[model samples]
Target: MTTLDNGTNSTPAPTLPAKPAVSMFAIGTAIGAILLTIITAISVGFSLGEIISNFGRKNSVVEGLLNPDWGQIWSRRSRSAFIETLQLAVLGTATGATVALPLALWSTTFGNPNRALRTLVRSFNNVIRSIPDLLWALLFVTAVGIGALSGLLALFFFSIAVTTKLTSDTLDGIDMGPIEAANASGASLTQMLRSAVVPQILPSYTSFVLYNFELNLRASAVLGLVGAGGIGARIEFFRGRGDWEKLWGLVVMFFLVVFIVERISVTLRRRLI
Candidate 1:
């Protein structure tokens, strides 16, 4: 409002320009999420009442968790199963993560310039990733006949999916200056990636491998359910016999080892990154 200096006259206040409204993209995202939630709930038959009615009921899972036979930790079978699980995890992570590195690099433009090859690699990676660890185990078990080899194969594809996705995310954000300089100096694609790209993401890549190992260790415990081998087979036996206490004990013992390894891996990853 403007006021006259020596008079009682006033003019209406001038309004400043309006600030921008919320973005359509943000609004659309919110709307889409709400719609998706609604659709998912409907499809899944989500019901709070069902959960409310069931929550107070006694369950074998709860009983097992409450009364785990910790003495099972000393069983020779348990020990052997645990060792097998560890071997499966180590071997699977080693093989899968090795292949994942090349696959991750090839999926990027700077690594594999061939559009068709890059797309194929990306599509394959995506397909492998879309399948869950359990499903992989089932497929491998079917193909190879229920054994540790099948479990190893499951973890292999699983580790590839995990490591490749995580590593590829880092690749796109690497410092491109060195990449350009390497190319400018007449280095070949493989040499540039090895020299320039590898150094930048080695820490992250190693960390991903370690993390994938941790996951494989945990997953290897259940692969036995599908006869793919490892401690999972013991778990299935315990479950089938309704030996909840022993089953829980085996599960707990396995996880304790996993917990310790994960702690060590976390420390290493922190040091790497």
Candidate 2:
């Protein structure tokens, strides 16, 4: 406090606190990341000059990319492949999501009474999630032979992994009041879960299922390379024959379809959540 010109007491302005110093740990981490990136780039023979020169050179692949055959969209074979891809995505999401809910619930302590069973369920979920979607497709393809059946099976397991993981995370945060109430009221385990748990997470579960469908649709294309069956197989066919024009056309159409579906899914998910 200080005396003003008119002899009235006045307070001085407050001083702001000094900012904290950067930590040694953060500095070390940044330096380590930079060193790692440089080493990796060197190991991979990264060359900007080569990349630019390659792109500038006249090549059939580049030419075909520039002049895609748009008419492939009208081809009956392409259309059939597109439909098959859609079917795989739909069926995979449906079946996978259906099984996922039960598995997710059973893995939880409140849902499954047996500790051994819960541990087993958790282990299964972990194993499924650890495997990539492409590997699943490849395994199924080898086991079932080249066909749509393999693609469906691959998507099924993939969907289960995705939806179950997401749903289980949601379950962890649910209100326990309803669950405890149901248990105190002499409800069976299944009854308690149905009345208390399903209602809480159904919206999130549905949103996850929709998101999984999008993933399945994109994955179906790649699965075709393994002969699991879908638009990917057709894409692979064009690639094998050096038909880049047709391949690019299919890619463009697929992009358009994916974009439209993504918009719809986003809208629905926004409403759900």
Best by TM-score: 2
Q: Write the per-residue lDDT of candidate 1 for residues 1-273, one digit (tens) a residue.
A: 223432353545555556779999999999999999999999999999999888779888779989899988688988888889899999999999999999999999999999999999999999999999989999988988878899999999999999999999999999999999999999999999999999999999999999999999989888888988888888889888999999999889878888999999999999988
Candidate 2 C-alpha lDDT tens digits along 33-100: 99999999999999999999999989988888889998897799999999999999999999999999
List candidate 2 segments past 4 Å from native: 1-16
Q: The CA-based lDDT of model 2 is what?
A: 0.92
**Candidate 1: which stretches are off by over 4 Å?**
1-31
TM-score of 2: 0.91
Question: Which window of 10 residues has the lowest lDDT sum in candidate 1?
Answer: 1-10
Among these predicted structures, which one has the highest lDDT? 2
Candidate 2 global Cα RMSD = 3.8
TM-score per candidate, in order?
A: 0.87, 0.91
lDDT of each: 0.92, 0.92
